[model samples]
Target: MADDIVFDLLHSEIINYALEQTKTTNGSKEVDLSVVEYIGFAAGYKIMERLTREWPRFKDELDTMKFICTDFWTCIYKKQIDNLRTNHQGVYVLQDNAFRFLTNFSNGHQYLEYAPRYVAYTCGLIRGGLANLCINSIVTAEVQSMPSCKFHIHVQRT
Candidate 1:
């Protein structure tokens, strides 16, 4: 419990600092977000590895992706995803009406512009988690407002 809190603090600080540095150095939000996503990727990969040890071996790629969207999402956010949609062709959308991390902030309109930073970290987490399952994919985050976020996962064609 205590460790989780500490890690959360550390994660927030690290992402913020990284974002600032990337913005100042390259002035690119995409790059800054990618750096943040990399952080998530590292964490997701490890967490998924550990999780796989206890979970049943998946027979379908879609099932594995759902596990990440539901079980993994809950583990990180304390709640399951609100909605999940898939095209059955490797495109998935996970929507969280009250994303836990974003819910903590009470920022008004100005916050929308900065929402991507937080969303990027989450996008990275999803991508990293999927990658560990041998499903190479790209994750992008869209925030319509505070506490509401959509994560788009596109599985790569190989």
Candidate 2:
């Protein structure tokens, strides 16, 4: 029911924001890569909303989050972004857009001028909205960091 509540909202907002972002910066860029990534973030943010509603204890652990991310990946992203629209015999289409949106966000963002910091900031944005309604605290850890980057995400108590 909640999925029905949020899917179209997430879908439209992400596409609209992606289009606005592309127009503001890349100047008429298509929704090839970056838009997909942005959509992933927005969709992930939404999915986290409904998901935690079912699994109440899912929070504040690196490995648990990784597992959730993995499921989210396989069920949503891997077939599309990792496989990139191949007609590979074994893959199935994701039932929704979560994969296209987040996978792109994770990968495409790596090329930004300040990739690590931007991601931390991104985590903040995602958390700012969902922390109270669904989540308690966000725990994000960058896979890599630079001396210039002061970003780190760790567990926070509710």
Candidate 3:
């Protein structure tokens, strides 16, 4: 349905545009971040459009921002991966039970060394892009023990 349209638009249309952007910068061979960052920005831009459309008169107040970030991590992203957590801070645990149910999905064969850094990069992609839309935030990740993935994210309202 709607997902089909978005998939076509992103893959068929937006993907070509992203490729052209890479070529203009000369193949992204010397600079790896070029390609990844391009995809990140494009995806981020599209997401922002959807966010604005869904919430017309967006007010980036503290409580409102908290709700949006929590909803994004817990509901949208968590569904795609098993055992995702959106817990922030200590004691209060402001958001005890978060993330509504959705289709379960798993990450692909993630590399051994990069599993944690990869997660951190994703967090930055989402957080940094959102900041472009006047939503100030920060993201960090950590994977301590090998094979066992552990990711931590710290987000603040601004």
Could you tally the backbone clashes for each prediction?
0, 7, 0
Q: Poorest 10 consecutive residues of model 1 by lDDT?
A: 101-110
lDDT of each: 0.81, 0.40, 0.43
> Order of all candidates by TM-score, from best down to worst?
1, 3, 2
lDDT of 2 by residue, 1-158 (tens): 45643743565465566557777886764433344444445656666655556554645344343434345434432432122221233222212223332333455435444343233333443344244334444434233322122212333443
Strongest candidate by TM-score: 1
**Which should have the higher lDDT, number 1 or number 2?**
1
Candidate 2's C-alpha runs over 4 A off are 1-42, 49-66, 79-112, 117-135, 139-152
Candidate 3 lDDT tens digits, 1-158: 57544643443344345446666778654322344444654566466656556654655344444544555444334422334444334111122121121011123333444343233334445655566566555544444433334333344553
Q: List ranges where model 1 is wrong by over 4 Å.
A: 1-5, 23-31, 107-110
- Encode model 1's per-residue lDDT on 1-158: one tens digit a residue: 67667756776798879978887998765645667778888988888888778898898987887787678987888788888899999899999988766776744455787777677778888888888889999888888767788988899997
- Estimate the overall C-alpha local distance difference test score of candidate 3: 0.43
| Alpha carbon deviation, residue 82, candidate 1 (Å) | 0.9
Of the candidates shown, which would achieve the greatest lDDT relative to the real structure?
Answer: 1
TM-score of structure candidate 1? 0.87
lDDT (C-alpha) at residue 128 in model 1: 85
